[model samples]
Target: VDDLCDRAVKASFASAGQGSYGEVSVLLTNDLAMCEFNSQYRGREGPANVLSFPAHLRSAHSRVEVEPLLWGDIAISFDRVKYEAKCEAKPIRDHTAHLVVHGTLHLLGFDHKEMLDIAAMKRLEVSSLARLGISDPYSAGVNVELSAL
Candidate 1:
């Protein structure tokens, strides 16, 4: 977990191409725990994939509330990741890297709520993964059906 977290932060710094000194604390747990977290925080039904909990909530907390520049904790459900990797016919490492990058971008405020924003976020994710020596996980050339798994 420590090594993966380090890689995730390094990946973020490399993607941003800036002097960002934020840490990504990683937790690898079961689907049940993640499902509870998702229900409480995201109002989701069940476990999905990676979940990012940003540490610094500026609006809700003040200067005396928490750390000055704490980034967040990224909780990854290995079960979900494993399932998705098999379903997508992608290497688990590559799939996990993609999700880590996705969660990092979320912490950095790169959302995909709109069409243009989705494209921009996808581009950034692809470029970042490339820098991390990971190919685009969602390239359109794969002739695999996710449900068939």
Candidate 2:
């Protein structure tokens, strides 16, 4: 858990750009809590691997310093991470790094709804994880060619 938090904080700060004092809290909780958060904040039902609740409520003039304000919270499901790691044959730490980076990217106004946007977001994640010595999560677990079976 310590390692997870450390890596997540580093990733969040790095992706937030320079002088970004945003503080993000990463929570490792059970599926029940995750489900509640998902429904309450996202209007969805079920436990997701990771969810980011950015300080969404901001005034028009808040953009200049949104980087320094308390950004938001990211919730991750440990069980899901472990299952994914084992299934994909990757270390849990690496998977955690990917998820953290994913959530942080969301904080930075990146999304996967568009191809170009996805490519850009992925590039940033790959580069950021490299700085932390984490493997390329974009092509790891659940990414291997298991069709041979």
Candidate 3:
């Protein structure tokens, strides 16, 4: 997980055109835990594959001079990720990498609420996954049931 996170973070930074210090926490847990978080924060009732909470709001008023950018936290459900990978015929490692990239983009303020924004985010995800040698998860023939980031 550590190695995967390292690669994902590097890809995220490159995609965002950011070269400064930043940190994001990634939590890999079960469906139950994910469900709790989903309900508590997103007002959704199911376990999501990935959920990101940006720290921008928390740090908006901070005046610290030496603080690294606290990008945010990402929570992922292990069971859901495995199931989705199997259903999509994608390797688990690759799928996990893709989720990290998706979540990181959210932490950086990317959203899929608009078509144009979704397109831009998808391009970044594709390029970042390519850097990790992972195929495009949204390509034709793959299931697209995964929720928007």
Candidate 4:
């Protein structure tokens, strides 16, 4: 999981034209915990595959000088990710990597609220996943159940 998180983060930074010198928390948890977070933060009722909470909010107010930027926290639900992977006919590792990349992009302030934003974000995810040797997640008949980030 740690290795996967590292690769996802690196890919995200590269795609975003940023240097990867920050710390991001990757929490691998279960469905119940994720449901609670989803409800509390997003006002959603179900568990999402992944969730991101950016640390920029803290840096915006803090005066401390840190070498590495503290990017954010990403929480992933193992059960949800697994289910999604199976449903999409994708390998679990590939699906997990995609979620990490998605969450990292969210921490960097990338969102998909609008059509243009969705296109841009999807392009980044596809490119990053390709670098990791994964195929385009949105290609052909693939259906990815994405959550609101």
Candidate 5:
């Protein structure tokens, strides 16, 4: 899981034009904990597959250079991942990989709040997943060209 997450984070950062060095904390929890987090943070009722909390960095002038910056935190619901994988008819590993990439992208300031934004973010996500040998998760009749990513 750690190795797959490392690859996903690296692929996401590379696709988003970020440096190789960085830090991201990942939490693998079950639905009970995830449900609480969803309610507390997102104000949603149910657990999400994954959620990202970006560590908004201070200004460049106020920080000191030392090690890789702590990008953010990502919480993934194992229960949700399993359920979604079965429902979507995708391999569990692939689904997990896609979610990790998705959460990493959110930490990098990417969002899918709007139509255009969704397209752009999805492109980057698909590209990153491709690097990990995972197919696009949104290939539900909507085609996304990898070359454009």
Candidate 6:
């Protein structure tokens, strides 16, 4: 998991043109903790597969001056990852890698609030995952179950 996370973070940073000097803290937890975070931070119920809390929200074009930048925190629900992977018929590692990359992109100020933004984010995610030998998660064959992340 640690190795996968390292690669995913590196790939995500590179894709966002953030170089490879930042730090990202990842928290692997269960559904209960994730549920609490989802409610408190997102004002939503139940657990999300992953959520990002940026140390300083900035787009790829922003100039960052902090030495050894602390990018952000990523909270991942292990239970949700497992469930989603099972539902999608994908390897757990692939699912986890995708989520880590997605959360890292979010930390880099990439959002899906608009259609263009969603496409841009997904492109970055697919390319970053490709660098890590993971496939595009948004492929047509993938199934998104209601309870899955």
**What are the per-residue Cα lDDT tens digits for candidate 3 across 32-139?**
998899898888998888988887743222334553568788988889889988887788898888888888878777788778877888898899888888887888
Q: Between candidates 1 and 3, which one is better according to TM-score?
A: 3
lDDT of 4 by residue, 1-149 (tens): 79988998899878876667888889999999999999999999989888989877432113335524688899999998889888888889999999999988887778877788888889999988888888988985776667736
lDDT of 5 by residue, 1-149 (tens): 99998999999988877776779988889989878888888787777778888786432123335434788899988888888778777888887888888888887777766688778888998899999998878877633221110
Residue 104, candidate 4: C-alpha displacement in angstroms = 0.4
> Which should have the higher lDDT, number 3 or number 5?
3
Q: List the global CA lDDT of all models.
A: 0.66, 0.67, 0.78, 0.83, 0.77, 0.82
TM-score of each: 0.80, 0.79, 0.88, 0.89, 0.85, 0.91
- From the highest lDDT down, the ranking of the candidates is 4, 6, 3, 5, 2, 1
| Candidates, ranked, TM-score | 6, 4, 3, 5, 1, 2
Answer with 2 or 3, whichever has the higher TM-score: 3
Q: How many pairs of residues collide in model 1? A: 0
lDDT of 6: 0.82
Segments in model 5 whose C-alpha atoms lie over 4 Å from true places: 57-68, 142-149
lDDT of 6 by residue, 4-80 (tens): 99999999988888778878998889999999998988888988889898888576546666635687899999999
Per-residue lDDT of 130 in model 3: 86
TM-score of 5: 0.85
Error of 4 at 29 (Å): 0.7
Where is the poorest 10-residue window by lDDT in model 5?
140-149
Question: Ten consecutive residues with minimal summed lDDT in candidate 4?
Answer: 58-67
